[model samples]
Target: MDTSRLLRTTTTVIAAAGLLLTGCTTGGSGKLQTAASSAQPSPDPTALRPYYEQKLTWRECGVPGFQCSTMKAPLDYANPGSGQDVDIAVSRRVATGPGKKLGSLVVNPGGPGGSGIGYLQAYAGIGYPAPVRARYDMVSFDPRGVQRSSPVECLTGPEMDKYTQVDQTPDDAAERAELVAAFKEFAAGCRARSERVLPHVSTVDAARDMDLLRGVLGDEKLNYVGASYGTFLGATYADLFPGRVGRLVLDGAMDPARPSLDLNRDQTAGFDTAFTSFAKDCAKQPDCPLGNGSPEEVGERLKDFFRKLDAQPVASGDPARPLGEALATTGVIAALYDESAWPQLREALRSAMNGDGAGLLALADSYYERGADGKYANLMFANAAVNCLDQPPAFSGPDAVDSALPSFEKASPVFGAGLAWAALNCAYWPVKATGTAKELVAKGAPPIVVVGTTRDPATPYRWAQALAGQLDSGTLLTYDGDGHTAYGRGSDCIDSAINRYLLEGKPPQDGTKC
Candidate 1:
C-alpha cells in the first residue's frame, strides 16, 4: 500500500519495456537562465552560471534512436554554493521532422519515482503521434532522487520483501506495533543509507532542477506532458515560472490543494470505483471468479479471500516468499490501474482462490519493480522520499488512522483500511515535511491543458477538475472512460487533442469531453 499518488505509468512501463520505475512565481529575462536564476525576484545568476551554461553531450544510449545525457543541478537550491550537485539523468529522441521544429517537449510519467527516461525510451519517444514527434523532441529525465539520479536507497531486496509482507491492516495492538516497527525500520534504513538527499528531494528541488534542465537544453519555454504525480510537478513549475510555460498538458492530475489525508481517502475511493468497474465487467464474463451478484458482493468475496490469506499465506512458487494479505492486496490494486489488466487480475484471482498464488505474486512483483534477479528498483524508496517531504503525514499514528477509519471506510469499504494504514508510513520519516498543500494557480502562464479520466483509479477525475480550475488558464479535457492517465491509452480523441496542443500550441476548448 504505497501512496496513492504513485502513478500507474510504472505499470504501463512494465507492460511495455519491462522496466520498473512536483512550484512558484515569475522573474527576470525571458531567456533560458540558471536553475535558480529567476526562482526569486533578483537572484545571483552568476553564481549558478556554470550549471545553466553546462552543455549536454548526448550520445546514443542502448535504446535505439534515443540519446542519453546528464544535467547537473544543485543538491540544495537554498544554498547553491554548497558545491554538492545531483546528476539528473536525461533522455531524448530528436524530432523526426516533416514540420517546423517546436522546442523540446519534456515528458514525465509520474511516480515521484517513475523513471522519466525509461518512459521516454519505452513509450513516449516511439509511441507518441508521428506529427507531434516530427515537430518536437520527446525528452524526459529521472528527477533528482529517482532512478539513475542519486536515487534514494532504503532496503535490500530481501528486506523489501519482508517490508512488503508487513500487515497493513492491523487488527490488534500487537499487529499495530509490528506495523509501526516495520515502518521505523524502513525509515531508519533510508536515514542510514540515503540521508543526505532525503531532505532535499522535495518537489520544489525537482522543479528547480527542471528549470536548470530547460536552460541547459536551450529551451526558453518548456513544452511538456506530465501524467499522475508528474502533473503536480508540472503545475508547480508553472506556478514558479509562469512566463516560462509553453504548451503543457497534465493528464491524470492531482490536486495540490488537498491535504495528505484527503488525498489518501480520495484515492482509496478512486480505487474502489475502478474495482467496481472491473467487477462489473467481470460479472459479464462466464468465468468471473468473484461470482456475479453485484460489485459489493464481489468486494466482500475479495475481502474474504484477503482475510483467508492473512490467516494462512498461499504458495507463490517461491519457497521463501508466499502470497500474504499485503502482497495480494497490492496485486489486486496493481491490476486495477489499467482495464487491460483486468483479465489478468481475474485469472490471478481464480488461481489464488484455488491455492496457486503465482499470478498474483507476479503482478505484485511488477508493481514493486522487483526484477527476475531478485533485486528491487529504487521506485518505492524515492516515492516515499518525495511524498513524505511534500506534505505532512496523513496520520500521526495508529490512533489517528483509527479515528479516520470511518471516513475512509465510507469512501472505500474494500481498500480503506489498508490505505489508511499506508498513510501512516510517512509519520515516521526522519525529516519534517518542507512543503504545504496549496492551490497552484500559474497566474501568468499560458493556457495549459489538463486531461482527466472519468474513472481513473490512481488519480481521480475530480482532482483533474480541481487542478484545472486552480490554474488561471487551464483547460479541462475530460475522457469519459476508465484507467489512469488519458493521453496515450488508446483514446484517439484524447491523443489527438493533446497532440494538437503540443504541436500547434492550441489547447482544446475548456470543458471539452472526449
Candidate 2:
C-alpha cells in the first residue's frame, strides 16, 4: 500500500472542461495548518449557506435496506458562487430502533478513494453490531472524487494494465525510463481527464464537504467511524468542527504529522512486519512454500521471486498480460489487509513460484478491482489525486529517490524500492498540494477512540498511538492481534468498548488493551 492507500473502493464521472480549479492554493510547506482549536462554531459564509441548508431527497437504491441521495458541494469552497458543483453520492440505512435513536453514525472505509456509500450499503449498514445498527441511522457518502460522486479519471483499462506492469525495480536505463514515463503518463492522463475536479479534491476540501453533509443530514453533531485514510479525514473534520463532533472512532489511524517520505517508509516497514508474521505462520503449514526458513531468509526468498518475475514475467492465463513484480507485490499487499487472506496468499505464492501466475494475478486484479472485462474501479485514480493534493512529493526525481534509497531499504529491504518509486508518482501530479501533514488535536471534541491492531500492515499500530496522543481527548484501544481494522473483525473487547462509547458516550479508558 502506498502511504496514500488503495485499500478498497471505486466510481465514475466526467469533470467539466477547463474550469478554473486553481484559485484556491496551499503554501506547500509540507505540513497542513492546524484547524482552529476553539469549541466555538465558525460562522458560515453567506454564499455557502444555501449548500448547508439544502434539503436532501432520499430514495431507495442498491441493496434493499439502503436509501440513496445526492448532495451538491461547491467544487471550490473559497468561491462557493463559482457555479461548479460536484455531486456527492450518499447512502443510508434508517435505524431499526428499539431504543432512543442516535442522530446518525457515518462510517468510512479509508481508501481516500473508498466508496463510503458502497461501504455503508455493503458492510456498515448490515455488518455492524445489531445493537449499534438498531439505534443510529447508518450513513456514508463518497468523498467528492470517489465512486458515484464526481470521480476522477486517469488512464483507460488497457493503459492502466500497461501502467501497473511497468518494471518498478528498474534494472537498466530503458527500464528506468519506462517507469518514469509510466508515472508521467498516469499523471498526464489524470490532468487531461480531470482538470476541473483535480485541485478541489484535497483532504481539507473533503473535510469541509463532510461538515456540509452533517448539516444537510440534520445532525446537530457528527458521529463518525473512520478507518485508515478515513482517520485522517475524520480527524480533519473534528479539528475543523470540534464543537460539532459527537463520538468519533478513528480505527487504524494515521499519523498526520509524518511527511510523505516518512509515511511511506513507515508503511514499507509495516508491510515488512506483516510479511514476517505471515512467514512465521506459513512455516507451520505443511506445504509452506517458503520452506521453514527464518523470516529474514523468507523475505530474501520473496524478493528473489519478485526479481525473477521482473526478469521473465510469468504467464497468468492471459497472453497479453503476465504477472510481473509490481502486480505480484500488490497481490501480496492485498492479502496483508486481513489475516483470513493469508492462506490464499500462501497458495498464490506457491503457484507463482512454480511459474503459474494466474492465482497471484487474480489476487492483484481483485486488489485493483479490475473486472473480467478489463475495466478498473476508479480507486487508484482518486487515491493518487487525493494523496497528491494532500502533501508535497516524497521524491522529486529518480536522483532524489536514489538518495533516499538507503533509508527506504533500511525500512523494508523487500518493499522499499518499489514504494519509493511509487511515491514518485505524486511528484508528477498536475495540481499543487493543498493539504499538509499536521498534528490534529480536535481540542474541544468529545472523547474520541483510536483503535490499532498490533500487526496491522496498512496503518501501523504506532500511528494509532501517535494520533491518540495528539488528540486532546483521544483514547487508544489496543488490539494485540493481526489484521487491518479491528472492531468488527471478531474482537469482543474492541467491539464492546466501541459499542459502549457510541451508545452511552462512555469512552474506554485511555490505554485500554483488548
Best by lDDT: 1
lDDT of 1 by residue, 216-280 (tens): 77888988888899999999889887888888899999999999999999999999999999989
**Residue-wise lDDT of candidate 2 within 271-366, one digit each (tens)?**
888888998998889888877888888888899999888888898998878988988988888787778888988999999899899998887787
For TM-score, the strongest prediction is 1
Please report the TM-score between candidate 1 and the true structure: 0.95
Angstrom error at residue 139, model 1: 0.7
Clashes per candidate, residues 3 or more apart or on different chains: 4, 2
lDDT of 1 at 121: 81
TM-score of each: 0.95, 0.93
